[model samples]
Target: MKYPSTSTRSAIAALLCCTSLVPGQTAAQDAVQLPDIILDSGAVADDQTIVAEAISAGGKLTGDILDIPASVSVVTSAEIERRNAKDIEEVLNYTAGVVTNSYGADDRFDYFSIRGFNAYTYRDGLTLGENFGGIREEPFAFERVEVFKGANSAVFGVSDPGGSVNYVTKTPRGARFGSAYGTIGSFDTKEVGLDFGDVLNADGSLSYRFTGLVRDGEREYPFSRNDEVFVMGGLSWQPTERTELTFVLDHLDRDDVPGSGGFPIGYDFDRSDTFFGEPDFNFRGTERTTATLIGRHDFGNGLSFGGTARFSDGNDDFGYAYVSGQTATDANRSFFASDSAEKVAIADVHLAYDPQFGSFASSTLLGFEASRSESSNKRYFGPAPSVSIDDPVYTGAPSSVPLFADGETEVSGRAVYLQETLDWNDRVIASFGVRQDWIDITERDLLAGSSATNDISATTGRFGLTYKATTDLSLFASYAQSVVPAGTGVEPENGEQFEIGAKWRPLGGGTLLSAAAYDLSKTNITRTNPVTNLPEPIGEIRVRGIDLEAKAELGAFDLTASYSYIDPEITENGTAGNEGNQPARVPNHIGSIWANYTLEGDGARGDMTFGLGARYSGSYFFDDANVAGESDSYVAIDAAYTYALSDNTELAINATNLFDEKHVAFGGFYADFYSPGREVQATIRRSW
Candidate 1:
């Protein structure tokens, strides 16, 4: 028999008997004495960011949104709760400078464009790796989403200059709380979810949280289903008041998935509810698991260290077909069935230094990051099936189809970076950072029995300054560089951006107004690589744009509005008939407005709230080539109502696309896609 060592046992005993708050208790802990700009992790108070006034994506360090020199947008947990978001894309549908749900009601993945390009999706500061087509994430598991705009390779290592999305997850809180809810909604949706947290030991050193969800839902297309199970557990141990460590594990199992539908151009939008695939043949499933660990230590000196690491593995299988070719009423279905797997490991560590010298103060950060990713997929093609487009006929699935060898990819990356921020008398702030990245990728083509390796290195940096004109206003300017590696032998894609912006709180606290204008250009434009699933340089593109936003919380009313204008041009490309044309699906104009009002009674039990919103997306080309005609612009409306049944219970109803407008969301991939007409959901929740 083996037991813990004497040193380990003594340490455990000391932690168990230390002066502390109870497990899951968020009280009586000593906070690191760093300035808000450094945003020491231990300084984050429980429930302080429900409205998300502070963000961590802009600079890899949590800080006030107003302090960051870039364009940033945050979708808070409170906001997500009120909206009852169905997917990640829907959660950011109304945010400025971005477009979501690009393919309408596609339930397989969340598609979105930020600042005219696809941005990286990260959770807790780590990428989930290129998808193997099987994994799905639940929106309810997140606490907030931060959108950091412009080139940020200096801080993040590798990325598209457009921006990045960082999802802050829900972890163990310092206090005890729990909630459970049941929901019923359009498309035969039924779901139940629970979240609970509490202290784990007599001393407040150990805390734990558990969140779970089970859902059965259907897609816009008839006969397509989406069934899921999600479970997450988190533990936080504060062995000492000034130091802490947290661990989290997340698992998602999708027993069934909604099929992806494809139709001909100019197809009738009214037929969105129609299913064109054989029910038994169109099937998909995904099983995934991920683990994350975060640790922070305040040396009690002016130095602190923060480290995070994550690992993920997933498996996916799909058996579905889409319209390959069609003429008038006859359609040719391309049958495809595939199996895929993905694994990823990523970690980041940083040391921060803060010092105050009279009127001048400074914060410096030195960091290292590394990651490894692998993916493989094998696919089979069966005999094509034919069905009438006007009136599709259902038939049984065909038998044995010959399989073909596919490809696999392995990617590894390592980076080192440093940043410094100087605060001059609290009036002028200057920020600067630089990073160097080394990447290696290997791809294997099974059928050809061939493999290739590519090694690349790049240096990126950013510089910015902010000047506080008054207590209520600030002005900023920034310049940044980014790079993305591509296929073997192809030079990596590179981009640069210059931006100027202003933030104002004219009405004082709780009110904010901001505006920004930027010029962004990229050489060696990139496309998704088949084997590695990473962007590979292809052409060149440029974009100039402006973003405007306003948000206010005045007494019983809360409101938010946004508008953006962009002009995109494909400056250089092969003779593919796309040069000098606007990039496909890049809208020129987008706007939205939303507001809510609360009516209160003498007691908290009788409170009532009403909310409404509207969004507009301008027309754009369906393909990079100008040959494809332009699409039609569309407007959407959403609404919600909530009633507090009691202190710990509530009833809520929400609707999206309230008017049931049948319109084309976007078009590409040789097929037309339409937005879902409308959806309504009702939920009853209890909390204590």
Candidate 2:
């Protein structure tokens, strides 16, 4: 019973030698049968956190997660080591319409929002760069974190109609493994990590894996600090058995003093650790490089083919000393500097088909994608030195901020797609999709020499339906469409969404419930001219939502919860007091909950675990006219503990914002963003 090696048995002996090349259909009708295209079903094995079922993210879908009718979330890696997650927006903080950090206590990147627009971050299914230029991701080199929410460009083509986040990497798993981790907390935090895998031969078809991380952290402002380094490597090749290939390389280095300016108008939250700049004049530096390639092949009655290619490069340098306005005690400063470089390239190809006509079952996919990106900037915006929010500050430095406004940008995209899914007997399911896109953009104002170019094209679509009356309930409906690319010359903003959902998995199936109601919209949208902030193409937006989710595992208890309610409007506005308002910050109730419990007993108290969490946000608005500058509602708490020092060591402790809630997680048209206070950590891990 020697299994694994992706057991395709040389693709079933080349489908029985292709039945003599299909002549006269003699070898039992050319004996060919194959299915199981290997899509996700990895990761969850470190004492499982109960994932029940998954797959179906950008791995181009192949069921489970209630047969995907949109709105997806998977955070595994045992929920990022039980929420000690350090980035990727803290692994989507309880996800459901999502909004994480949104520009508050930054960590060089990852500012989020979904369902109310703006989202980007993908990595195994490509494009892990560019989201306003600083893309940083390294949640211990991911092994899960997928969020799909609205409009995925019908299979990730042009992106951002409120959703898309991938990150799945952590490859090469053929056998022998090792792991190590260490962490220590509270501001002077320190961390170390490593993971390794092996199987360089012995006919096991070659394998390799490595992941690394080193972090030295400190933040709560006041001379901020955070230095990070990460490295990842992978290689896997199968030779034949319908072939498989994987290669990946990664690198990231960052030096930080980020979270630059925010907090001025009346500066509340008890001053939230005020720091009017000049901890030697602020800083942010980064270097990133990545490469990826993945391939798969299989051919039998149910064909299959796969591909992925990615390349990324980033280099950024930042400087800041800002707080532009404030009085009662003086505060008015500005100094910005930047140096940038970003490059990205992506490619994808696909072909998949699974068929059976007897009881009618089907799965089909076709794809093509290409992308190119470039960004270059050198900026400096002057005027500094003015402090005292309550008692003065240092003088300027970093050579006193000088060069201003230089730019360059380039973007290219191409796409093609087709998808289909159908099943009639297992209780009727249906799916359909179509996509087309073309985009080109170039811009340069390198100190006002001026240059611009634009091209656009679009088509997007999606349709879904699912129904399964019993055996754990299910009902769904969906409609989606999206198109972006707007600005250089205009035309290309359209978006659409419509959804209805219900899913249940009661007692026997153990707990998992979901609900959704949505109406999303976007159009034209480009308005800003409070007297020459320029850019106006009128604007329109609409968002109406309701989403709720629950996940559970009962015997030893584990739970997760989510809720969201949106309702954002700005339906057409070109100023005039910001027609309809309510855009900045977009929040109308967002909730989260988490729970965990475990006691186990290897005969005499060996394992233990406990966790609790909570988060809520509501208030909104901070600009775009809607006056009085809102942003008040808040709540936060988190806790965790784990111990299991036996079979292969483990110890954990985690906390976030626990009790140190400073209100306003974000609300900045120009200042007001907090949360970077409580964080306590402790960890030790070992495995073999």
lDDT of 2: 0.74
Report the C-alpha lDDT of model 1 over 238-272, residue by residue, as the tens digit: 99977989999998877565444667666674544
Question: Per-model C-alpha lDDT, please?
Answer: 0.77, 0.74
Colliding pairs, model 2: 380-403, 380-404, 388-392
TM-scores of all predicted structures: 0.90, 0.32
Query: Residue pairs in steric clash, candidate 1?
Result: 21-204, 22-204, 23-199, 24-174, 25-174, 26-174, 525-538, 525-539
Model 1, residue 113: distance off in Å is 0.8
Model 1 TM-score relative to the real fold: 0.90
- Model 2: how far residue 320 lies from native, Å: 18
